[model samples]
Target: MSDPITPTPEPADADAGTYGPFAYLTAPNSVLYRRVMRVLMVEKERFTVHVRPEQVYAGVAVDGGDAVTEEAVGNALESLADGRWGNLLAFPDSSRVTAIEDFYRRRMLFQLSRAGEAAERALAQYDAALGTRGSLQSVALEDIVALLITLRHTVSEHATGATVDAALAHQTLRSLRERFVELADNAVAFMGSIQRTIDLHDADVEAFLAYKEQLVDYLERFINDLLVRGAAIAELLGSLDAASIDVLVTIAAEREAVDAAPGEAETAAASARQAWLRQWSGLTDWFVSTPARESEAKLLRARARSAIPALLAVVRALHEKAGGRTDRTHDFVTLARWFATLPADGDRHRLWRSAFGLTPVRHLSITAATEDAWASADLGNVTPWADAPPLEISPQLRRTGAYERRGKAVRVTDRSVAKALLVDRARQEAEQTAAARRRILTGGPKPLSAFGVLDPESFRLFLALLGDALAAMGPNPETAQVHTSDGELTVTLIRTPGSGVAVINTADGTLAGPDHLVDIASAVDEAAGDLVNWAAG
Candidate 1:
């Protein structure tokens, strides 16, 4: 107030010529004011500052360049502890400080308040800078935006106080705004790059999902085809078993021998004598007409009568050759009587014609006793033979004549009889040939049931499914084919050709693959174990 309190000169190291309230406070004559300005400037930069009436007095004394004790500093600090300094610094009207002393006091208070707020804000900004120092280089776009907002606030706050130099404030705000703008641009660029990366990742993942779905579908179809093919092989084997042919060689040999005999004269005469007896006996007996009777009565009687004599003669010859009893003779009367009573007109005559050297005749009525009797009587089997009774013939000859007895006549001819036998034999041969053909064509068993086995349509579906699987497996060049036991199924794997890789099945035709035979066997065993457990459950 007095003489405007001119301050002392500034130190040589001070930045520039002082201006405003600080200029008056530092004049050489106003030692107190000069010391006060020095204390205020130094303290404001170093430690926390409080401005009160008592602290203001201390500041004026310290301005005289006197050394202030620790107690003095403490008293000054305590005096400014209340909030009066804050009110003065915040005074709304800038025109209130008319004098130099008033300007000095008011400006000092304003500088202190503004410096404190700037220091606090600077400290916060420094901490923020330290916390995000590395982050500014690598932080996301959102974090950069947040940092810019804080920086803007800090610059604005620092610009508010009148105590701060107008030029310094302008410079700081300009620099801060420039920094914020640069950071915001960098953040925008960073966000755009990150979004692009995310878009690429999404596209790749979607493609992978579609590929996986296709792969699964292919695998399912492949397995189904393998199973169907295996079943087809099994069905084929069954058909083969049903059609095997078995030839009766013994019957064929007997037929050959009968075809080899000599002359129509002796054969016809022997046939006529046998025909007459067959007609008379068949009319007399019903029981003797059956097939059972032919074997028991006619065949046994024939054997007893004809074969026994030869067998006895051979035994006699052998016994004589061995120097043993040769006089042991078999009773021929029992054999002769059995033959005499047999149904002459029965199937026995046809059997006799087949057994003896006689030409076979048509319409011989060998099917039943009554028919045979009528046929034999008409052909004359009911009458006696004119010359010798018919002699026993070789076992090779087959019966082949019609008989006449009394005035009845039965005509016997080779042509008609041969045709009937040929037709009968043809039927038998055809059946045998067809059965053999079926056996060869169908493997071994009967055809599978309509629904139980895989049909042609199902097989086609299986092929399609297998084709899909092969495509999904990515064009394997190797391949393998296998047949099932029943000769029905044929399984094929489409794989990398010439590659060692292959798909195979178990001996029982179960699907197995992706490994060697040994590995497939092991896998099958494991699968069987699982099946057993499932069955128990």
Candidate 2:
């Protein structure tokens, strides 16, 4: 440990100078003084009494430091006791001793004086101001309203004052002017405060809603009242005598009136009357001069009016936040809250696997075979990653960063067999279709008499032609067309009015009766429009 501050002589009867917060340590780079004060303050807090040098030193010094010298500690004590440097008082004491030699000897107990205490409190306030750096302090709407009412009353009172008594009028004019300045300055700061409050609390939905409620109440109380007061001020200004006052001559006369003897009553009364006029002139000159764009009342009225819409916007924003009907971020907040409700040690692994359609857990002992037969790990494999390309990683493996173990590929057992069978069946159907299409194209159109026998494909075509002929009897012919569902083939039907029946045989059955004579024409596409032209004609 270092050393304790030495005892100084008890304080003498000397007048002290004013000191502000931490004034003793306010010297240029007074690091030592500041540390001593902090230690003393802490000791006082812990013990709830005065601090002695020894207590101060024990708190200041760290363990395993160079031993503190007695002279250096003593100098700090002297500084605390000195009238110019210290804000503390050193009281002489005989009850306790710090050293073995002074066990029964006298010492000094030090405590902060009133000035020092005030300074320390000021320092705390300074720190608090730093923490919440002021956004223009809210102007009390009540204060402005009160000032305006009082000012209008003062102006009116001057008009009816005693001819020789200007004392109240003069004082009232000065007060009104000062209050108006304050109102204007604070009006600006108040607007800034509202804007800053909005920006700061925009994301804090609960606080913004709360503030909006209060702001609504605040505006409600003030807005209508401001309108009424502004009207009163304007009407009062119109009635005030703006022309019959001269300040310089009245000021000179008032001074002379103050010096007048008691016998010179008439002379004193005349000066007093002049002074009253001067007071009225001063009030009216500033508030209601000639050729003005906006009087003080008008400016104040505008301020009160503008504040309403700004306040409404803030309320509208808060209303939007409270009802999560518009903002996308509100949905995100809800999802985050749901995630937060999950237990810290919840079994998320199973949920994650099912949600993403993952395969059953597998071991790497039976890895899938690859086309490259040479793709095997090196002998010894001291560092497997040294020569390996980026691994074929599963999404789950990438997230968990698993390396020591891996999953085997899930075997697709039925897909290939099912796929091969579908391919063979489709190929057979396609070959038969190609053969049928070639016969239809080569034979172009056929009379019903020539169709003596029908193969499976041709019989299918005959059934389609029957459908077309029956559909042509519809009232809405535009919707009834002889085209396949995929629109690849168009069929045209003809009724030849023949005298005898025609017959055809197929492998499935014999379709024999259709002889009132029908001919069939087929076209594969719209470009081969033989059927389309025949249908149109």
Query: TM-score, each model?
Result: 0.13, 0.34
Total residue pair clashes for candidate 1? 54
Over 310-365, each residue of candidate 1 has an lDDT whose tens digit, in order, gives 43344445446458443424434544465577775565565556545475555342
- Which 10-residue span in candidate 2 carries the lowest summed lDDT? 133-142
CA lDDT of every candidate: 0.38, 0.56
Task: State how far residue 92 of model 1 sits from its true place (Å).
Answer: 19
Task: Please list the residue runs of candidate 2 whose C-alpha ends up more than 4 Å from where it truly belongs after superposition.
Answer: 1-85, 89-167, 170-186, 242-537
RMSD of each: 55.0, 30.1
